[model samples]
Target: MSVQLVANVLIGIALVVFLGYRQATWRYLDPTRIWRTPLIMAIVGVVVLAQTTTTITTTDVVFLGIEALITVGVGLTMGSITRFRTVATPDSKGRTIQSRTGLLGAALWIVLIAVRVGLDVVGGHLGAHLLTSTGTILLVLALNRAARAVVIDQRIPRDDREARGMMVR
Candidate 1:
């Protein structure tokens, strides 16, 4: 791979780790913000779909369909890991707040990135494209974020939802 490609991959890995940290430490944000992630994911999916429409074939269609299902399952699984790993403790004010260093969130990012890179390497040598499409990536992200948002939101008590940054049991 080119130096630039390597650099990009490293940067992407860093970005994922950072985002996972944010997710792990996420406290109760605005309820309206709940839609932001899904909306962004949808927009990204649309843009990716639009760019690839011309190249899509029947085989690609089937592959994309299968990929979407797999992404959802994997996304939820990872989200659950993040949820289970996230540490919630009460602040001095007696409201729950997630810990800053989310080891589980970092693990989630590492696992996903490793799987993607591993599959890409194997598939590339086999002359097949796996997880190589924008649709595939965007869908995975959207599903993960949406599912996490739902899972986390549901866990927060209704009163805490309105509170600034407290995580309620």
Candidate 2:
């Protein structure tokens, strides 16, 4: 009913979807751990909903739309990342690019954030708030990328000299 309630619900749904994808796609994820995702989502949703006021603007709607597009792009990118192949036989190439998916995904996310912030600026907000919000988005993206990189790297084991046909001695 309220704008804050809507935003919180949307964000909560997004978190649940993200967690479901992680659980289904990652072999390491435990089935028991899956419940934690929605629980966390609910907790976050309540907190956010409690803090937010009900007012919203046209720009806010546009921002949410852009974010939805970004979410879809990221999901596709994750699927692509999981399907990439890096080996043309262990003996052939020294090393290969595991996946360009993460980079592509990150780029798409950055573009979405940039467009949203740019629109905010163009729409109004000609003050410190605009710059602060933009900077915050960039920082969040950077941290997200870092976290994703760590997870992905852990999922795929790297072939060392011994594994790739070089003698250890």
Each model's total of backbone clashes: 0, 0
User: In terms of lDDT, which candidate is strongest?
Assistant: 1
| Residues 69-160, model 2: lDDT tens digits | 55445544543454334445433433442333434454554454565456546544632222223223333333333344334434444443
- Top TM-score prediction, candidate number: 1
Each model's TM-score? 0.61, 0.35
lDDT tens digits, residues 35-96, model 1? 47666867876786567544445554554565456556655654455432223665565555
lDDT of each: 0.55, 0.41
**lDDT value, residue 122 of candidate 1:** 57
Residue 132 Cα positional deviation in candidate 1, in Å, after optimal superposition: 1.9
